[model samples]
Target chain A: MEILSLNQISPDQVVLLQWGVVRITATLLYTWVVMAILILVAILVGRKATADTAISRWQNLLEVVVSSIREQIREISQDEPDHYTAFIGTLFLFIGLSNLLLIVPGYVAPTSSLTTTAALAVCVFFAVPIYGISKNGLAYFKEYFQPTFIFFPFHVMGEFTRTLALMIRLFGNIMSHDKVIAILLAVTPLFFPIVMHALGLLIGMVQAYIFSILAMVYIASVTQAHESHGRGP
Target chain B: MHIDWFVFAAQIINFLILVALLKYFLYDRIVKAMDARQAGIASRMEEAERLRQEAGRHLQEMEEKKRQLDARVQEILNQAVRDAGAEKERLLALANEEAQESRRRWKETLAREREAFYDRLRLTSGEIIFSTIRRILGDMADAALEEHVVDTFVGRIRGMDEQAQELLRRSLDDSRSEVTLVSAFELRPDQQEKILSALGPFLSHDVTLRCEVRPELISGIELVSQGYRLAWSVQRHLETLEEAFKEALREELPEVNLENAGGEDAPAQEGSRQPHQSG
Candidate 1:
């Protein structure tokens, strides 16, 4: 029965190892597998992409999805989405794909564990500063010291807290939904678990949306101008 | 929170790989295609606009040409109308000239016809008067009238003015002159001698005297000495009356044949004939 919790939330399992002191976790393995799958599919679909006036239907689908992502990024940043498309679009694809992959029977959403959620949050945390420094030069740092120099420590806390909140929120929501389903499977073993699975899917998508939007807010706060940075409260 | 920093690093690597894959396969090509399609549509729109402008220019040119053609047509029509008016005027002038010339010719023909009619009337009147006088004098011819004509002729010779008598006297003095006496009636030898004796005073003594009796003289006696003549007859009296009538008619009519209406002319050619030879 605990095989249902066979996500990273389950007991430890490490296949790849380095000497006696080092080891790998299920979270890293699952992440690498999903990453490989995504990359392989992207490469295969990319082979059929057209550059001429008449485009393949597959290319059209890709264009619509990418353009939607660009439009979303533009709405969030209010500046040009030319540079931010890769990061934001990937953030959306990874989270959304990770949530959608949960439809597999024994598979766990990677965000169901705090370790993977923390990893994604950490990536956003580092990406915000790196993008800010690269785009606005010294102006990005000014947002941290805004209003007064005394607020610098508070700005630092806000950054850590927001990243922590993103990780915790995604972990709690996904984990609780899976836990609820697992418990329902034990107690009822019937219709409610199935019903909760559907609800959990809906919550998974919402949590992915929240996580990406929070990341966009953090990045927008630094790299984008104040007047243009109005999205993702 | 059972978290491993090592696994976090691995997940971050996984996320980066996913971003690179999605960007290469989806975002870059899709945006490029969209941009290409947009550029194509813009170029097509520009081409369409250019074609539209060209068509507009062509339409304007055609309209301008049509306007010019219309103006030319109007000018031609006006010119035609003007030519027609000029032709009408010319024709009218020609017709008027022809009408005027015709009227002048008619007037000339009428005047000529009136002159011919007047000439014929004069000729006819002369013939009528001559006929009537000849008939009247022919009806009055008798021996007594003949004796009276001789007496009157002798008395007329006796009553001659001095200048007339001297002209007669000069004629009789010429040696080449011969005295001739003619009568329309036959005269006896006694009458002939009497007529010759009566003319003896005007004639020279050596001048020969010739007496002739001719009924064609129409009751007149003609005595000629050189170029001088003296005679009296009923035909002569009637001729004198016809001359007076012709003079009266001459006052009423501008053209009358007075000379041809009287004297020696008669209806019958042989009814009277007289020739008096002097010189």
Candidate 2:
């Protein structure tokens, strides 16, 4: 457990699967753990969920969470929230659970590992085009050539660069927060490290929310592009 | 920076798996529940609105019924009042009619009673007057009254109106040539001679004289020939006196009344005989 190794930017992972040169890592294991927790809770809460006026405590909590995400999706999408709920909701949950696991001892946050963050960012990168294409068809590509054909390169580069930013932004924040806590604890061995870890928790949730919102914005921009041209949907 | 392509690929695969798993477990179920609850709330609100509209309609119907009931009640009350007023008027008219009939009946009864009382008084007065006069005349009668009556008849004949003289003459013609003289008492021969001499001028020729006494003629004399009745008797005088008294009684008792007093006029002996007839 090389917690304070500045030279190796990615955390040492406990591998889960390996085939010839390909490897599955511990970050994947932790992400799987988060996935299991989310899945199990969803199952129990889903059973508790009722269409009646009165509801159970679990159903009430889940309703609050689901509605809040629905409202956020509606604001960004400016369209129906039904189709986008799953994609945006899964992104927030995965990232939020990864940060939430920080309170457990010896738990390495999957978000704090570059490969894990890059993988999540890569999913968002692919999801934007998928959602945009699904909403507006091939016409969604017109937004890239907007203003002039001269803006085409900048628009194309902007997509990959934003994807890179999404990856680096999450990875840098979680990794640096973890490194600072590790350094504080290695030096002071106590209180300052605990405070910084708590701060890191807040930063982790903020980053997850930012990632989800950005993905939603990207999908909405493409879907709503024709509205600016006075074409009623 | 050390980059491992295999780990990166594995991490990306892991993330895609997480996205898929979470989407299936959490996002799908929760969103479906949320959509169902929204539909339920909308259904509940619509039901509440329907119930409220029904309640309003029911309230309006009730109000209309109440208004009709109130109007019916008022009509009944008005009819009752009208009937009562008409009944009161009919009853009052009946009472007034009954009162008038009773009053008229009472007046009739009173009038009949007054007439009966007057009839009894007249009968009693007649009897008393007749008896009283009979006694007075009986006491006064003798030959003097007869002589005076004979003189009055002679004087009446001398100054008679032509129509009366003719009437008396015609009556005398129709009879047998005889005259009858009645007296209350037996008369002397000389007295009869004087009466006969006094009446001789009115006779057409010689008239045979017949003398008779009637006790009812309490005083004076009466001469009868055919349909001519020349009388100056106490019975006839008494009748005249009773009539005078009845006239006086009628004047005094105007309200009580003695309506029928039979007073036939006497045949007067001209100017001299007028006093006796007037009495």
The most accurate candidate by TM-score is 2
**Model 1 per-residue lDDT tens digits across residues B232-271:** 6555555555556666667765654545533355323222
Best by DockQ: 1
The TM-scores, one per candidate, come to: 0.57, 0.59
Docking verdict class for candidate 1: acceptable
Each prediction's Cα lDDT score?
A: 0.73, 0.75
In candidate 2, the residue pairs with backbone N, CA or C atoms under 3 Å apart (3 or more residues apart, or in different chains) clash, namely: B156-B269
